[model samples]
Target: MCKPLSDAISQGRVSTEEGERKVWAALEAAISHFIEGGLVTDDLMKQLLPRKYEHWELRSRKPRPSLRVFGRFAMPDVFVGTHVERRDRLGAKWSPQWEHQKLVCEDHWNEAGLPAPFTDQPSFLYERYITSNARQKIRVQL
Candidate 1:
């Protein structure tokens, strides 16, 4: 996590303490599941499309005004989060905000001198980086 993102989470920027807790819990759960080699369904984590974004999001959607942690994979099984946002607050005019978030992630990667994200097809990403049974466990609700 970047300083800004960590600060946002720690400072309860998700509007309420409960909201913050939910987001934090979801993030922790997802990370633990990933580390254990469990398949991360799209509902839990999604790679943005068009490939150019090279961005991924860890989503917490159970509560209203779901939270998103914007980041990119630094390598197989490694994600570096850069920003946080509320899904509802992103509004219908979301493309620009989404692009902005992508830019923020890119800047973070550059500042950290991280390697470029893997921007291959979804299948390729799964095959190369994720667990072998990832395809079978995939649930495409995105």
Candidate 2:
């Protein structure tokens, strides 16, 4: 996990205890899924990571994501938690922390000598609760 994420959780980044719990669960789920070599569904994991650091944003203290967790796969089996953000509501608005976390994650990957831009192939957003045999890959804008 990254410093920002730890800091967020320690500092009570979210407004409600429920939100914090959800964020905590999300981070744990991310780590667990990553360790098992699986992709996290968007409902649980949203990719807000940018390709560069210059585009990062400094977030304000309002209208934040309810259960936000940011990270990237530094390697096939290695997932680095770069940052965590949580609020009373999970809005679809763009998050500055998202980019910042991505930048942190990217830096970690670079220092570790891992390849950047983790995937070159197209990404598919999969359903969250569907079983593997019943799951469907839907091509969507990222």
Candidate 3:
């Protein structure tokens, strides 16, 4: 789980208790599927949908209020969540919050020394593990 995401949930920064519960439930389900070496796709669960921002693949979870987990596949089975943005129903469908997170992820990726995105071809640089079905590997820091 992401620290910021967890902090948001724990701090009750969500819209409502029901929304919070739904987000947590959806997260648990996704984690379970990940642990079972399964891809959490729209087919498996409608909530976990793949979204693209340039070459980055983000996993967005639309709970009651829509909690967006911005991340990219560090590896096929490894999704590193970088930021969490909460969207209340009254807000615009799209927000600059998402763009900000995308920028943060890009900077973090560059800092981490990950392969750079192909500028000419606009191809995914982390596509090497696309076919991998490895079990969920959670990297916990003590």
Candidate 4:
């Protein structure tokens, strides 16, 4: 959560901590970009984000500034924007745009019943960069 990122830099002064906090906050901010307009992610991804960027802002060429959410756990990379991205072995960063297209996005409100898709709206990811549940307060554990 933002608190942990803050605590990571709690020892510093306002300006110092501000920068330090950014380092810690970048991943969370990225996941919360709100571009995909919904929050979603796994636990392991959260760990890798701080590791890769050390809290650096997750910028992009397109720079639409979408909400970042989705720690897939498959890759431990910190990504900003709706598309979760990662650095390849050659050190080139690759946005999981395809993966986003396939894995991200919302489904029907009710799995079995007739309900409208919520894709028109945004999704929310909490402080730890964990996506909120379909109904909120519900953790999706695979």
Candidate number with greatest lDDT: 1
As a whole number from 0 to 100, the lDDT of residue 61 in candidate 1 is 77
Q: Pairs clashing in candidate 3?
A: none
- lDDT tens digits by residue: candidate 4, 1-142: 2232233323322445454445335544434553344543332132223233222223221222222332222112223222233222113233455233223311211222323321211222323343333122446699
Q: Give the Å error, residue 74, model 1.
A: 1.6
Can you tell me which runs of candidate 1 are displaced by over 4 Å? 13-16, 121-124, 136-142
Question: For model 3, how does the per-residue alpha-carbon lDDT over 104-132 read when each residue is reduced to its tens digit?
Answer: 76666566566543231234323333344
- Local accuracy of candidate 2 as per-residue lDDT tens digits, 1-142: 6576677666654536876556555555544664564644444434443323212112223223445555554433344565654543434445564434455656654655545534423442323222242223334778
Stronger candidate by lDDT (2 vs 4): 2
Where does candidate 2 have its weakest 10-residue lDDT segment?
51-60
**Could you tally the backbone clashes for each prediction?**
0, 0, 0, 16
* Candidates, ranked, lDDT: 1, 3, 2, 4
On the 0 to 100 scale, the lDDT of residue 130 in model 4 is 30
Clashes of 3: 0
Worst 10 residues of 3 by lDDT: 42-51
Instruction: Evaluate model 2: give its lDDT.
Output: 0.46
Kindly list the per-residue Cα lDDT of model 1 for residues 39-133, writing each as its tens digit: 66666677776555668887777665578888887766677888788887665534787777778878877877777776555454544544443
Off by over 4 Å in 4: 1-16, 35-70, 73-90, 93-142
State which candidate, 1 or 2, has the greater TM-score: 1
TM-score per model over all chains: 0.74, 0.45, 0.52, 0.20
Sort by TM-score, top down from the best:
1, 3, 2, 4
